[model samples]
Target chain A: MNAILSDYFLPCLWASLASAGFGLIFNIHGRGLTICAFGAGLGWLVYLLALDAWGQDIFAAFLAAIVCGFYSEIMARLRRCPVTGYLLVALLPLVPGAGVYYAMQYCVQGENERFLTTLLHTFGMAAALSVGAMLVTSVLRALLPKFHRAIH
Target chain B: MNDDKLLALGAELGRRLMSSGAEIYRVEESVIRLLRAYGAEPQVFAVPSCLFISLSAPDEPAVMRMCRIPAHGTDIELLEQCNCLCRELCRNPIPVEEAFEQVTHLEDRCRKHNPAVVLFGYWMTTAFFALFFGGTLPDCLSAGLCGLAVGLCALFGTRITGSNIFFRTTVHAALVSAFAFLLLRAGVAQNLEAVTIGSLMVLVPGVALTNAMREIMAGDIFSGLNRTAEVILVATAIALGTALPLILGQYI
Candidate 1:
């Protein structure tokens, strides 16, 4: 894990910085910085883990979103701030900008299967991440609205 | 002077007003208005409250809390008497000012590094170098540098360009293809992969990946998935562009 973290040094550094920038806009306070940064770091980890799990350079991206949401709530409550700061930062890693582009290139070249599979996977991963965040938040709200409300 | 304090003040306000019965949208608008009143151009979106982020100046401030604040009065009162509410609500105007100043300072920094120059310059240069000298460097260094260039450009591109997915991907891919083609003509003493590595740098959507994860965590599957596709597309485009020239090289 350390090795993988150390490997993509620049991406990690920039992503962290970007997360910090995000923190400022959303008015993330106290632990919000930590929460935001964790999301960013872990988001990158999604790609690394996906590569290890699937043996391809993919981002299993759902985890990145889910983790970001879970942490955003946890951190927001802890810090008594909003979740926007952390969520945006955490989201830095799973944008699928590269995936969508490649899929198009493949399609343009008439490589249908590669395009379809890659495109589907990217979209699926994104869908999973988004749904996960909503589920966690709704569950959190249902399970402990009082605790969650205290943060804001 | 610091960004944290302003954010803290805003957060405190958010926390304090949660019990006052304001919808999240009202609070968001109020906050954005406050930021704007102070001359900071904070972007305030009314989408998922979970994603309420601002790109006002140099730094993007994030929303940390999720509590709802009650509007002080009805629409008739608020719309008719904003000045009264403004004075009544703001306890610590200093924090708002400080935050505005900090963001303005940041906005200045962003303006200094024009996206057109940075994106275009890096795109052309990375490709030119990869084509001319790709064989001379180590594989890791080549890929790393290329990645650095593209990653950096994404930051500016996100800000300068319109917020459209298709536009962003198309520009990124087209640039990568242009650079890859240039490298092909240079005929450097490198294999296809090495050259590909160089051009591939401009296409990594590192930010998108992180954002997707964040959305998922925020529990917005539709948004999270949409974003993931965008980031992945960028990477694929870079790879394909560099590879295309190689395959065609055999014929040429």
Candidate 2:
């Protein structure tokens, strides 16, 4: 239990808090900021779980981004705000920042082979994240009004 | 109210949404909805840097308003406020004068986060990011310190009049990576890559990239391409800036 807490739960909590901090930088306020943080945390948790299960980093990113996008859409509908507010901060944790850094480092050192590999991987992961979010958002956009009518 | 005043109000609302980092489609939709509520037919074209809105009521000529939006930082609170205001306008159409007054008040009432809070936010972002990237305790501490420096740079970078973004980004990235390099050299951090990456995460253009993808998928090809260029430019600036110090340190 302690190990699980330290390994998974704590990291997820930290991810949430970190996302909240990011929201603060963009001047998010009130309960909205908290929801954004929670969405990030949930997405990170899903990413970690998928990574462990599938051992594919790109797939993990895609799955996590889908979760984040769905969360953002639901929250936007509930709160009546633009989806960008929640989606932007919630997707922060999954961004391939380290990959970009390493790719550039390899390029600068003239390690062409490693640089190409890392750069390709970084772009692949970014594309996966974007595609995941896009799919979910577009689906929601198409179906939401129908869902609303059914509910009413 | 006159069509001119209604047109101006719609344009102003669109401008505010764009400046606050609302997506292009959202801004365009809101303007159209607001103008329609006011019994006017509306047409809107919005990109990241500018917005144009034209409104016409029956028996009156269309009046167009175009504004060059100044580059501004994202403020989600203000975006939410504006979104709420537009929804209210659409559901319960208000007089043009009252709508204009509310928009002006919202513009004035937009709040900026306190400097100290922003600095703390930066620190938390890096420290947690270090942990998320599998950094140890010392690595997280070092990244947090570097984050404070990056935060200070960002706070002051905005104050300098006419500072080019590329130059500011490059300088800030170099400074943070150099600081991380020093920490590694002094044996204060176990992993230089983790520390540097964690600190660099704050500067990544994640939001821009996400928005770009969404725009393209939504078939706003021109705006999407423009945003994609912005994301690549920013990413390249950050990467180059981070690499410079590491390369120099290797020779030294």
Question: In candidate 2, what are the lDDT values of residues B71-187, reduced to their tens digit?
Answer: 777889889889888888888897899999998888677777899999999999998888878899999999999999989888876676245667777877898899999999999
Number of the predicted model whose DockQ against the real structure is largest: 2
What are the clash counts of all predictions, listed in order? Answer: 86, 0
Over 4 Å off, model 1: A1-38, A43-64, A79-81, A95-98, B1-169, B180-252
**What's the true lDDT of residue A149 in model 2?**
27
By lDDT, the best candidate is 2
lDDT (Cα, 0-100) at B216 in candidate 1? 55
- lDDT by residue (B5-107, candidate 1, tens digit) is 4454444443333222223443555666555444555554432223243433555545333333332211111221232233333433555655444333331
**Span of ten consecutive residues with least summed lDDT in model 1 chain B:** B71-80
DockQ of each: 0.11, 0.68
How far out, in Å, is residue A138 in model 1?
3.2
User: Candidate 2's C-alpha lDDT?
Assistant: 0.86
Model 2 lDDT, residue A17, Cα = 83
